[model samples]
Target: MLAMGEVHTGLLQNSGEISESTCRQVLGLMAGETVRVSRRPIPHALSPERLTGVDCALPSASRSRIRGVGTVVSRCAVTGGRVAQGSSYVRVVRSEADRRLPWSHYLSRPGVVEVLGKAKAADLAEGFVGDPAPGCLDMGAISGRFLDLVQASPLLDRRAPFRIPRTSLRWVAETGEPSIRFTLHTEQERTLRLTHPGPFTPAVVDLCEDLATHDWLLTSLLIIVERARIGATPGAQAVARLAPAIDHLLHLWMPAARVEEWLRPFWESLERQPGFTRQWRSLVDRVRDQIATSTLALLSAATEAGRR
Candidate 1:
């Protein structure tokens, strides 16, 4: 649906956030469930104001916010990874496991709503010996190696140095458990909880990331909207909103006409992007290639899990 260069070009045109209308269209395509929408502000937890460029760990979904449901819980390991030191835990008290959370949940702590968060962006980009400059535009489809970072097992940028900040799959293999643990916990100290089974494996991890990243691609999109509030003109402004094409993947079930219709106004606000035309071809191909490879690896791993 993304057709070749469109998705990444959109990413180049718009930084990372994808508009909600586009998200609904994309999600409708991929799932059987009805897609819901809500709008809210970013949480203080993941706020740069709180961390002050410290590059803190990804924000955790707050169980406190969601109302009257079965409990929501999440556990994370702060092992010797690139960010954070102490362990992390989240629980939506009395919330249902499948319960829909408040929209704010997606803003500050991306884990609750979207798969790939700012932490993933800043940290995941590590270890590239020859990546363009830090300021250069980074546009491309989601890659497979990146999908590995989504898994509960440990993740490392393929280019990580062999020293302390390791990136290979070794930690998971060594632990015989997914190094990045996630679970439902009851107490601050985790007196009660639910946990995902061993290995958390390459397949499940990426699947979760894909789910979350899709959401991230949608909601945090308000970030671009927020940028527009300041009166920045299109092309004159850095990319901030969803491109019409990206909705294809997330809003798979939506009618194409409605998607384009929704995107029409948003399009009027576009700021022209520089260089997106020049570097787009090879970058898009590279991203698609990565996706193709990751798709196979995840499917094979999931298939084995099912067979077991």
Candidate 2:
């Protein structure tokens, strides 16, 4: 069995974190489906799960023809009422019959895709992580549509504090000795390969979402600091450019906040190698110092003027 998914993370297009009632209205993707909410560690809400029918070729590294037919499960989530994520995944399994079944047959098993022909798990995993070929299952597009639905809601003012591009994380997991490999492909793209000891579960999906959220936070902050041009630009001007980070992006560095205890080790392993929090703290401090210096300069100028 294999689980593959993509998560798109970005800031909510609002002035500040929204209220629970507002979240309910914005995240209500389907009728008769309750939007789950948890208010403790952080205010979070999830839209009801929705499925999209998919009958496409499964990506394979060996160029072997592999076709899959099934539905892809997707949902929208808001964390701290500030961050929005659209996550979609499908479980791949061998079909009992080597032919295309009726759509209803596939719909009966939501989020599960049955491969009609021979396909190795390794090949599928590699193809997904590597460059995607044409006509392959486009989970990103499905996920993007769900995000678009939430962002296009009239309830939102569409005034995001800053214009940070959405980041995407593609992940594939299979049953084996526990192991995880996360790779940052580009500025806006990341990929992960994992081997878990037991059966695949939604807890794994939660773990992926958590990782994507924190990675996006780190990436957004780094972009803000770079654009500030601290040494080259005037102190006040640099501070002005960094204001968004202070106002909207900082204080969102919580990692593993929603992850289960069993998945803590994965987050820990990522911390040791990439040092996500370490880098985030350094950037936060730099932003604060710049703001402080800018304030002092303005004060000193005011005092001199008074003396004159």
Candidate 3:
């Protein structure tokens, strides 16, 4: 069995960080479900899990037609009332019966897609993370719509402090020897492959979401720093360009904050090799250095004026 999912992460379209009350109001997807909130490490809000039904061709590496029918689990998450994420995933498993089951039957097994024909889990997994064919299961598109829903909330003023592109993280997890691999394809696209020792659990999803959040923060900060043109532009102008990152994202680099203790090693492995935090710290220091330099120049000018 393989569980594949995608997370679309970006800044909330609001001028200022929203309060918990407003966060709840914006993430009120279902009528009766309550939005979950946690404030320990930082303020976080999660919308109730919603299901989207799909009966489509599951992507297969061999180019064979494999049909799957089930519901996809999706939810919206707000971190520090600033970052918003829309996530969706489905578990693929072989079906006992040959043909499709009734709608109620599929609904009973939420987030689990049953394969109706002969197919290898590896094939489906590879095809999904690799270039998926047209008319295949499109988790990215589904996740994007959910994120758009939250971004389009009437309660929000749609006045984001900075305009940055959203990042998409598509991940696949299966039971096997423990290992994890993360790949960055383009500016807005990333992929992860995980093999754990036991059955699939929500903890894995939490781990992926936490990684997605921090990855977006890093990517957005890099963009901000590049656009600042620190050396090319005047010191004051460069400092002004970096002001948004300082105000919004420099403080949000808490890795594994929401990941379970058992899952910490997965994050640790990536940190050791690629060093996500190391890169983020370097960029942050540069932003601060620019601001400090600009401040010192202003103070020196004031002193010179007073002397004259």
Task: Name the best candidate (by lDDT).
Answer: 3
Pairs that collide in candidate 2 are none
Misplaced by over 4 Å in model 1 are 1-194, 230-308
lDDT of each: 0.24, 0.90, 0.93
- Winner on lDDT between 2 and 3 is 3
Off by over 4 Å in 2: 306-308
Model 3: per-residue lDDT, tens digit, 1-308? 89999999999999988999999999999999999999879888999999999999998888889999999999999999899999999999999999888899999999999999789989998998898899999999999999999999998899898999999999999999899999999989999999987899989999999999999999999999999998999999998889999898988788998998888999999999799988988999999988998999999999999999
> Tens digit of lDDT per residue, candidate 1, span 198-301?
42222332223222222223322333334333224432122222232223222221111112232222212211222221233333343344445556767988
Q: Which has the higher lDDT value, candidate number 1 or candidate number 3?
A: 3
Clashes of 1: 29
How many clashing pairs does model 2 include?
Answer: 0
Each prediction's number of clashing residue pairs: 29, 0, 0
Ranking by lDDT: 3, 2, 1
lDDT of 2 at 233: 89
Against the hidden reference, what TM-scores do the models get?
Answer: 0.19, 0.96, 0.98
Worst 10 residues of 1 by lDDT: 1-10
lDDT of 2 at 178: 83
Per-candidate alpha-carbon RMSD to the true structure: 24.0, 1.4, 0.8
